[model samples]
Target: MKKPAKIWLWVALVLCVCTTGLNLSEGRWLSVAIAIVSIIGLCVLLFGQRKAGYIVMCVCAVGSFVVGVTQNMGELGAALAIVMSLIGSALVPVITGLFIKSQWKELK
Candidate 1:
Protein backbone atom coordinates (compact mmCIF):
# COMPACT_ATOMS: atom_id res chain seq x y z
CA MET A 1 0.00 0.00 0.00
CA LYS A 2 0.96 3.64 -0.45
CA LYS A 3 2.37 5.78 2.37
CA PRO A 4 -0.80 7.84 2.79
CA ALA A 5 -3.01 4.80 2.92
CA LYS A 6 -0.74 3.13 5.43
CA ILE A 7 -0.75 6.20 7.59
CA TRP A 8 -4.51 6.44 7.40
CA LEU A 9 -4.86 2.82 8.35
CA TRP A 10 -2.62 3.29 11.32
CA VAL A 11 -4.64 6.29 12.35
CA ALA A 12 -7.79 4.25 12.08
CA LEU A 13 -6.24 1.54 14.21
CA VAL A 14 -5.25 4.03 16.86
CA LEU A 15 -8.72 5.53 16.83
CA CYS A 16 -10.21 2.09 17.26
CA VAL A 17 -7.95 1.32 20.19
CA CYS A 18 -8.72 4.60 21.86
CA THR A 19 -12.41 4.10 21.34
CA THR A 20 -12.13 0.62 22.73
CA GLY A 21 -10.41 1.93 25.82
CA LEU A 22 -13.12 4.51 26.33
CA ASN A 23 -15.82 1.93 25.97
CA LEU A 24 -14.07 -0.34 28.37
CA SER A 25 -13.91 2.37 30.96
CA GLU A 26 -17.60 2.97 30.52
CA GLY A 27 -18.29 -0.76 30.94
CA ARG A 28 -19.75 -0.95 27.50
CA TRP A 29 -18.76 -4.47 26.55
CA LEU A 30 -20.49 -4.48 23.19
CA SER A 31 -18.89 -1.25 22.09
CA VAL A 32 -15.55 -2.53 23.23
CA ALA A 33 -16.07 -5.67 21.19
CA ILE A 34 -16.95 -3.64 18.13
CA ALA A 35 -13.90 -1.47 18.56
CA ILE A 36 -11.72 -4.54 19.00
CA VAL A 37 -13.14 -5.99 15.80
CA SER A 38 -12.45 -2.75 14.01
CA ILE A 39 -8.87 -2.84 15.21
CA ILE A 40 -8.52 -6.33 13.82
CA GLY A 41 -10.02 -5.25 10.52
CA LEU A 42 -7.56 -2.39 10.34
CA CYS A 43 -4.73 -4.81 10.97
CA VAL A 44 -5.99 -6.86 8.06
CA LEU A 45 -5.88 -3.77 5.91
CA LEU A 46 -2.32 -3.10 6.99
CA PHE A 47 -1.48 -6.66 6.06
CA GLY A 48 -2.76 -6.02 2.48
CA GLN A 49 -6.05 -7.92 2.56
CA ARG A 50 -7.78 -4.85 1.23
CA LYS A 51 -11.19 -6.23 0.32
CA ALA A 52 -11.70 -8.22 3.50
CA GLY A 53 -10.44 -5.38 5.65
CA TYR A 54 -12.71 -2.88 3.95
CA ILE A 55 -15.72 -5.11 4.36
CA VAL A 56 -15.02 -5.76 8.02
CA MET A 57 -14.48 -2.13 8.73
CA CYS A 58 -17.65 -1.13 6.89
CA VAL A 59 -19.71 -3.67 8.80
CA CYS A 60 -18.25 -2.65 12.13
CA ALA A 61 -18.86 0.97 11.36
CA VAL A 62 -22.51 0.35 10.67
CA GLY A 63 -22.77 -1.80 13.77
CA SER A 64 -21.25 0.94 15.84
CA PHE A 65 -23.65 3.48 14.41
CA VAL A 66 -26.64 1.30 15.14
CA VAL A 67 -25.44 0.57 18.66
CA GLY A 68 -24.90 4.23 19.29
CA VAL A 69 -28.33 5.19 18.03
CA THR A 70 -30.03 2.55 20.11
CA GLN A 71 -27.97 2.65 23.28
CA ASN A 72 -30.25 5.02 25.13
CA MET A 73 -27.45 7.48 25.64
CA GLY A 74 -28.14 11.17 25.68
CA GLU A 75 -28.34 13.22 22.52
CA LEU A 76 -24.72 14.33 22.64
CA GLY A 77 -23.39 10.81 23.15
CA ALA A 78 -25.52 9.41 20.38
CA ALA A 79 -24.46 12.18 18.06
CA LEU A 80 -20.81 11.55 18.80
CA ALA A 81 -21.21 7.86 18.12
CA ILE A 82 -22.98 8.53 14.86
CA VAL A 83 -20.30 10.97 13.76
CA MET A 84 -17.42 8.66 14.64
CA SER A 85 -19.00 5.71 12.86
CA LEU A 86 -19.65 7.82 9.79
CA ILE A 87 -16.08 9.06 9.71
CA GLY A 88 -14.70 5.53 10.13
CA SER A 89 -17.05 4.19 7.47
CA ALA A 90 -16.09 6.97 5.08
CA LEU A 91 -12.38 6.45 5.66
CA VAL A 92 -12.52 2.79 4.66
CA PRO A 93 -13.76 3.52 1.16
CA VAL A 94 -11.41 6.44 0.64
CA ILE A 95 -8.42 4.42 1.76
CA THR A 96 -9.51 1.44 -0.30
CA GLY A 97 -9.90 3.65 -3.36
CA LEU A 98 -6.48 5.12 -2.82
CA PHE A 99 -4.91 1.69 -2.56
CA ILE A 100 -6.75 0.49 -5.65
CA LYS A 101 -5.66 3.53 -7.61
CA SER A 102 -2.10 3.00 -6.59
CA GLN A 103 -2.28 -0.63 -7.60
CA TRP A 104 -3.83 0.29 -10.94
CA LYS A 105 -1.10 2.79 -11.65
CA GLU A 106 1.51 0.19 -10.85
CA LEU A 107 -0.17 -2.35 -13.11
CA LYS A 108 -0.08 0.16 -15.95
Candidate 2:
Protein backbone atom coordinates (compact mmCIF):
# COMPACT_ATOMS: atom_id res chain seq x y z
CA MET A 1 0.00 0.00 0.00
CA LYS A 2 1.06 3.55 -0.68
CA LYS A 3 1.62 6.17 2.00
CA PRO A 4 -1.74 7.78 1.32
CA ALA A 5 -3.55 4.47 1.53
CA LYS A 6 -1.84 3.60 4.78
CA ILE A 7 -2.72 6.98 6.17
CA TRP A 8 -6.37 6.47 5.32
CA LEU A 9 -6.35 3.06 6.90
CA TRP A 10 -4.82 4.51 10.03
CA VAL A 11 -7.42 7.20 10.13
CA ALA A 12 -10.14 4.59 9.80
CA LEU A 13 -8.62 2.52 12.59
CA VAL A 14 -8.45 5.52 14.89
CA LEU A 15 -12.02 6.46 14.12
CA CYS A 16 -13.20 2.91 14.78
CA VAL A 17 -11.43 2.79 18.12
CA CYS A 18 -12.77 6.15 19.16
CA THR A 19 -16.26 5.19 18.15
CA THR A 20 -15.99 1.93 20.00
CA GLY A 21 -14.86 3.70 23.13
CA LEU A 22 -17.67 6.17 22.93
CA ASN A 23 -20.23 3.43 22.43
CA LEU A 24 -18.87 1.46 25.32
CA SER A 25 -19.01 4.49 27.59
CA GLU A 26 -22.62 5.05 26.60
CA GLY A 27 -23.50 1.38 27.10
CA ARG A 28 -24.35 0.80 23.49
CA TRP A 29 -23.37 -2.82 22.99
CA LEU A 30 -24.46 -3.20 19.39
CA SER A 31 -22.68 -0.08 18.27
CA VAL A 32 -19.56 -1.14 20.07
CA ALA A 33 -19.68 -4.54 18.40
CA ILE A 34 -19.95 -2.90 15.00
CA ALA A 35 -17.04 -0.62 15.76
CA ILE A 36 -14.96 -3.54 16.93
CA VAL A 37 -15.62 -5.36 13.71
CA SER A 38 -14.70 -2.29 11.75
CA ILE A 39 -11.48 -1.94 13.72
CA ILE A 40 -10.55 -5.51 12.95
CA GLY A 41 -11.25 -4.93 9.30
CA LEU A 42 -9.09 -1.83 9.29
CA CYS A 43 -6.30 -3.76 10.95
CA VAL A 44 -6.53 -6.43 8.30
CA LEU A 45 -6.21 -3.75 5.64
CA LEU A 46 -3.21 -2.23 7.37
CA PHE A 47 -1.56 -5.62 7.52
CA GLY A 48 -1.78 -5.93 3.70
CA GLN A 49 -4.80 -8.21 3.36
CA ARG A 50 -6.49 -5.60 1.23
CA LYS A 51 -9.30 -7.61 -0.35
CA ALA A 52 -10.29 -9.37 2.84
CA GLY A 53 -10.21 -6.13 4.78
CA TYR A 54 -12.27 -4.38 2.17
CA ILE A 55 -14.89 -7.10 2.31
CA VAL A 56 -15.01 -7.03 6.06
CA MET A 57 -15.33 -3.27 6.16
CA CYS A 58 -18.05 -3.27 3.54
CA VAL A 59 -20.05 -5.89 5.43
CA CYS A 60 -19.71 -4.02 8.69
CA ALA A 61 -20.69 -0.74 7.12
CA VAL A 62 -23.79 -2.24 5.59
CA GLY A 63 -24.60 -4.07 8.78
CA SER A 64 -24.32 -0.90 10.82
CA PHE A 65 -26.40 1.03 8.33
CA VAL A 66 -29.13 -1.58 8.43
CA VAL A 67 -29.14 -1.71 12.18
CA GLY A 68 -29.27 2.04 12.47
CA VAL A 69 -32.17 2.24 10.07
CA THR A 70 -34.13 -0.57 11.64
CA GLN A 71 -33.56 0.57 15.17
CA ASN A 72 -34.46 4.13 14.45
CA MET A 73 -37.24 3.47 12.02
CA GLY A 74 -40.16 5.97 11.90
CA GLU A 75 -38.31 8.65 13.75
CA LEU A 76 -36.35 11.67 12.61
CA GLY A 77 -33.64 10.98 15.16
CA ALA A 78 -33.21 7.46 13.80
CA ALA A 79 -32.98 8.84 10.30
CA LEU A 80 -30.20 11.13 11.46
CA ALA A 81 -28.37 8.22 13.04
CA ILE A 82 -28.60 6.21 9.86
CA VAL A 83 -27.17 9.07 7.83
CA MET A 84 -24.36 9.64 10.26
CA SER A 85 -23.38 5.97 10.36
CA LEU A 86 -23.51 5.79 6.58
CA ILE A 87 -21.17 8.75 6.31
CA GLY A 88 -18.90 7.91 9.21
CA SER A 89 -18.58 4.13 8.96
CA ALA A 90 -19.08 3.74 5.24
CA LEU A 91 -16.90 6.64 4.14
CA VAL A 92 -13.77 5.28 5.75
CA PRO A 93 -13.53 2.12 3.69
CA VAL A 94 -14.53 4.02 0.59
CA ILE A 95 -11.76 6.55 1.02
CA THR A 96 -9.30 3.77 1.76
CA GLY A 97 -10.43 1.87 -1.30
CA LEU A 98 -9.96 4.95 -3.46
CA PHE A 99 -6.45 5.44 -2.18
CA ILE A 100 -5.65 1.80 -2.74
CA LYS A 101 -6.90 1.98 -6.31
CA SER A 102 -4.91 5.11 -6.97
CA GLN A 103 -1.79 3.52 -5.56
CA TRP A 104 -2.29 0.42 -7.67
CA LYS A 105 -2.71 2.51 -10.79
CA GLU A 106 0.43 4.42 -9.99
CA LEU A 107 2.30 1.17 -9.57
CA LYS A 108 1.12 -0.09 -12.93
Candidate 3:
Protein backbone atom coordinates (compact mmCIF):
# COMPACT_ATOMS: atom_id res chain seq x y z
CA MET A 1 0.00 0.00 0.00
CA LYS A 2 0.99 3.59 -0.52
CA LYS A 3 1.53 6.19 2.19
CA PRO A 4 -2.02 7.57 2.09
CA ALA A 5 -3.50 4.12 2.11
CA LYS A 6 -1.40 3.24 5.14
CA ILE A 7 -2.50 6.38 6.92
CA TRP A 8 -6.14 5.70 6.20
CA LEU A 9 -5.76 2.14 7.42
CA TRP A 10 -4.32 3.50 10.64
CA VAL A 11 -7.31 5.80 10.92
CA ALA A 12 -9.56 2.82 10.36
CA LEU A 13 -7.75 1.03 13.17
CA VAL A 14 -8.38 3.94 15.50
CA LEU A 15 -12.04 3.96 14.50
CA CYS A 16 -12.20 0.22 15.16
CA VAL A 17 -10.88 0.73 18.67
CA CYS A 18 -13.32 3.52 19.29
CA THR A 19 -16.12 1.39 17.91
CA THR A 20 -15.19 -1.40 20.29
CA GLY A 21 -15.06 0.96 23.25
CA LEU A 22 -18.42 2.54 22.43
CA ASN A 23 -20.18 -0.74 21.85
CA LEU A 24 -18.60 -2.32 24.90
CA SER A 25 -19.85 0.52 27.05
CA GLU A 26 -23.30 0.09 25.58
CA GLY A 27 -23.13 -3.71 26.04
CA ARG A 28 -23.48 -4.40 22.33
CA TRP A 29 -21.54 -7.59 21.88
CA LEU A 30 -22.06 -7.95 18.14
CA SER A 31 -20.69 -4.53 17.29
CA VAL A 32 -17.80 -5.23 19.58
CA ALA A 33 -17.10 -8.39 17.62
CA ILE A 34 -17.25 -6.46 14.37
CA ALA A 35 -14.76 -3.99 15.74
CA ILE A 36 -12.51 -6.84 16.83
CA VAL A 37 -12.62 -8.22 13.32
CA SER A 38 -11.65 -4.82 11.94
CA ILE A 39 -8.66 -4.66 14.25
CA ILE A 40 -7.47 -8.10 13.25
CA GLY A 41 -8.27 -7.35 9.64
CA LEU A 42 -5.94 -4.42 9.54
CA CYS A 43 -3.15 -6.43 11.08
CA VAL A 44 -3.56 -9.23 8.62
CA LEU A 45 -3.83 -6.79 5.75
CA LEU A 46 -0.47 -5.39 6.64
CA PHE A 47 0.99 -8.84 7.04
CA GLY A 48 -0.02 -10.02 3.53
CA GLN A 49 -3.47 -11.51 4.09
CA ARG A 50 -4.77 -9.31 1.31
CA LYS A 51 -7.95 -11.18 0.45
CA ALA A 52 -9.08 -11.56 4.06
CA GLY A 53 -8.16 -7.96 4.68
CA TYR A 54 -10.41 -6.84 1.82
CA ILE A 55 -13.28 -8.90 3.13
CA VAL A 56 -12.88 -7.62 6.68
CA MET A 57 -12.60 -4.00 5.63
CA CYS A 58 -15.65 -4.24 3.42
CA VAL A 59 -17.58 -5.94 6.22
CA CYS A 60 -16.56 -3.30 8.73
CA ALA A 61 -17.66 -0.46 6.47
CA VAL A 62 -21.00 -2.11 5.77
CA GLY A 63 -21.52 -3.00 9.40
CA SER A 64 -20.90 0.54 10.53
CA PHE A 65 -23.24 1.91 7.86
CA VAL A 66 -26.04 -0.47 8.79
CA VAL A 67 -25.68 0.06 12.51
CA GLY A 68 -25.43 3.82 12.29
CA VAL A 69 -28.48 4.13 10.08
CA THR A 70 -30.50 1.83 12.26
CA GLN A 71 -29.53 3.70 15.40
CA ASN A 72 -30.15 7.13 13.89
CA MET A 73 -33.35 6.32 12.04
CA GLY A 74 -35.42 7.64 14.91
CA GLU A 75 -34.02 11.13 14.43
CA LEU A 76 -36.41 12.17 11.71
CA GLY A 77 -35.47 15.83 11.79
CA ALA A 78 -31.79 15.09 11.53
CA ALA A 79 -31.85 12.98 8.39
CA LEU A 80 -29.19 15.03 6.64
CA ALA A 81 -26.90 14.87 9.64
CA ILE A 82 -27.49 11.16 9.89
CA VAL A 83 -26.58 10.50 6.28
CA MET A 84 -23.50 12.69 6.43
CA SER A 85 -22.29 11.11 9.60
CA LEU A 86 -22.85 7.63 8.29
CA ILE A 87 -21.00 8.39 5.08
CA GLY A 88 -18.20 10.04 6.96
CA SER A 89 -17.80 7.16 9.38
CA ALA A 90 -18.03 4.54 6.68
CA LEU A 91 -15.62 6.25 4.29
CA VAL A 92 -12.52 5.61 6.34
CA PRO A 93 -12.74 1.88 6.07
CA VAL A 94 -14.35 1.84 2.67
CA ILE A 95 -11.76 4.08 1.09
CA THR A 96 -8.93 2.25 2.74
CA GLY A 97 -10.27 -1.07 1.56
CA LEU A 98 -10.69 0.15 -2.01
CA PHE A 99 -7.17 1.46 -2.05
CA ILE A 100 -5.75 -1.77 -0.76
CA LYS A 101 -7.84 -3.82 -3.08
CA SER A 102 -6.59 -1.82 -6.04
CA GLN A 103 -3.04 -2.59 -5.02
CA TRP A 104 -3.58 -6.35 -4.94
CA LYS A 105 -0.67 -7.02 -7.27
CA GLU A 106 1.66 -4.80 -5.25
CA LEU A 107 0.68 -6.00 -1.78
CA LYS A 108 1.97 -9.51 -1.64
Candidate 4:
Protein backbone atom coordinates (compact mmCIF):
# COMPACT_ATOMS: atom_id res chain seq x y z
CA MET A 1 0.00 0.00 0.00
CA LYS A 2 1.04 3.57 -0.54
CA LYS A 3 2.41 5.38 2.50
CA PRO A 4 -0.54 7.79 2.64
CA ALA A 5 -3.02 4.94 2.50
CA LYS A 6 -1.14 3.09 5.22
CA ILE A 7 -1.25 6.16 7.41
CA TRP A 8 -5.04 6.35 6.96
CA LEU A 9 -5.31 2.70 7.94
CA TRP A 10 -3.35 3.35 11.09
CA VAL A 11 -5.67 6.23 11.94
CA ALA A 12 -8.62 3.89 11.45
CA LEU A 13 -7.10 1.27 13.73
CA VAL A 14 -6.62 3.86 16.44
CA LEU A 15 -10.20 5.06 16.09
CA CYS A 16 -11.48 1.52 16.37
CA VAL A 17 -9.53 0.88 19.53
CA CYS A 18 -10.75 4.13 21.03
CA THR A 19 -14.32 3.32 20.11
CA THR A 20 -13.99 -0.08 21.75
CA GLY A 21 -12.56 1.48 24.88
CA LEU A 22 -15.28 4.12 25.14
CA ASN A 23 -18.09 1.63 24.56
CA LEU A 24 -16.68 -0.73 27.20
CA SER A 25 -16.36 2.09 29.68
CA GLU A 26 -19.98 3.05 29.16
CA GLY A 27 -21.20 -0.55 29.64
CA ARG A 28 -22.57 -0.54 26.15
CA TRP A 29 -21.90 -4.17 25.30
CA LEU A 30 -23.81 -4.11 22.03
CA SER A 31 -21.93 -1.05 20.86
CA VAL A 32 -18.71 -2.73 21.80
CA ALA A 33 -19.62 -5.79 19.75
CA ILE A 34 -20.41 -3.60 16.76
CA ALA A 35 -17.09 -1.84 17.23
CA ILE A 36 -15.31 -5.17 17.32
CA VAL A 37 -16.87 -6.03 13.96
CA SER A 38 -15.67 -2.71 12.63
CA ILE A 39 -12.20 -3.41 13.98
CA ILE A 40 -12.23 -6.75 12.16
CA GLY A 41 -13.30 -4.98 9.00
CA LEU A 42 -10.42 -2.53 9.29
CA CYS A 43 -8.03 -5.42 9.83
CA VAL A 44 -9.29 -7.13 6.69
CA LEU A 45 -8.83 -3.92 4.72
CA LEU A 46 -5.35 -3.39 6.07
CA PHE A 47 -3.94 -6.91 5.71
CA GLY A 48 -6.20 -9.11 3.63
CA GLN A 49 -5.17 -10.11 0.12
CA ARG A 50 -8.51 -10.05 -1.67
CA LYS A 51 -11.16 -7.58 -2.80
CA ALA A 52 -13.31 -9.01 -0.04
CA GLY A 53 -11.83 -6.41 2.24
CA TYR A 54 -13.93 -3.79 0.48
CA ILE A 55 -16.99 -5.84 1.25
CA VAL A 56 -16.01 -5.90 4.88
CA MET A 57 -15.52 -2.15 4.84
CA CYS A 58 -18.91 -1.57 3.27
CA VAL A 59 -20.54 -3.81 5.85
CA CYS A 60 -18.87 -1.85 8.59
CA ALA A 61 -20.05 1.39 7.05
CA VAL A 62 -23.66 0.29 6.98
CA GLY A 63 -23.45 -1.13 10.48
CA SER A 64 -21.95 2.06 11.77
CA PHE A 65 -24.63 4.09 10.04
CA VAL A 66 -27.45 2.15 11.63
CA VAL A 67 -25.98 2.08 15.10
CA GLY A 68 -24.83 5.66 15.06
CA VAL A 69 -28.15 6.90 13.76
CA THR A 70 -30.24 4.89 16.15
CA GLN A 71 -28.11 5.73 19.11
CA ASN A 72 -28.32 9.42 18.38
CA MET A 73 -31.91 9.44 17.16
CA GLY A 74 -33.02 10.67 20.54
CA GLU A 75 -30.89 13.76 20.19
CA LEU A 76 -32.68 14.95 17.09
CA GLY A 77 -33.85 18.00 18.91
CA ALA A 78 -30.25 19.13 19.07
CA ALA A 79 -29.43 19.73 15.45
CA LEU A 80 -25.75 20.28 16.05
CA ALA A 81 -25.38 17.12 18.08
CA ILE A 82 -27.26 15.04 15.52
CA VAL A 83 -25.18 16.36 12.67
CA MET A 84 -22.00 15.76 14.58
CA SER A 85 -22.99 12.20 15.36
CA LEU A 86 -23.98 11.62 11.75
CA ILE A 87 -20.68 12.92 10.51
CA GLY A 88 -18.36 11.70 13.23
CA SER A 89 -19.55 8.20 13.99
CA ALA A 90 -21.15 7.41 10.64
CA LEU A 91 -19.01 9.14 8.05
CA VAL A 92 -15.47 9.28 9.36
CA PRO A 93 -14.78 5.56 9.10
CA VAL A 94 -16.11 5.40 5.56
CA ILE A 95 -13.92 8.35 4.67
CA THR A 96 -11.00 6.56 6.26
CA GLY A 97 -11.66 3.56 4.03
CA LEU A 98 -11.84 5.82 1.00
CA PHE A 99 -8.43 7.16 1.91
CA ILE A 100 -7.13 3.61 1.69
CA LYS A 101 -8.38 3.06 -1.86
CA SER A 102 -5.07 3.95 -3.42
CA GLN A 103 -4.19 0.25 -3.41
CA TRP A 104 -7.26 -1.13 -5.15
CA LYS A 105 -5.17 -2.59 -7.97
CA GLU A 106 -2.94 -4.38 -5.52
CA LEU A 107 -5.90 -5.88 -3.69
CA LYS A 108 -7.58 -6.90 -6.91
List, residue by residue over 1-108, the lDDT tens digit for candidate 4: 777776777787897799789879988777788778777777776777456765665666666656666776776645654576567666545676576566677885
lDDT of each: 0.69, 0.75, 0.71, 0.70
What's model 3's lDDT at 59? 80
Check candidate 1 and list the clashing pairs: none
Worst 10 residues of 4 by lDDT: 77-86
Q: Note the clash tally of each candidate.
A: 0, 0, 0, 0
Better of 1 and 2 by lDDT: 2
Q: Quick one: RMSD of model 3?
A: 2.9
**What does the lDDT come to for candidate 2?**
0.75
lDDT of 1 by residue, 9-92 (tens): 777677668778888999989878987887787787677645676667778878877776667446557667567656644665
Q: What is the lDDT of residue 81 in candidate 3?
A: 46
Given candidate 1, what's the lDDT at residue 32? 84
Off by over 4 Å in 2: 74-79, 103-108
| Clashing residue pairs found in predicted model 2 | none
- How does candidate 4 fare on TM-score? 0.77
Q: Which residues of candidate 4, in runs, are more than 4 Å off? A: 76-82
- Model 3 clash tally? 0
lDDT of 2 by residue, 1-108 (tens): 777777777877887788789879988788789878878877877886557777788889888888667666566477687786677667887787787875543331
C-alpha lDDT (0 to 100) for residue 20 of candidate 1: 83
Measured against the true structure, the TM-scores of the candidates, in listed sequence, are 0.72, 0.81, 0.70, 0.77
What TM-score, to 2 decimals, does candidate 2 have?
A: 0.81
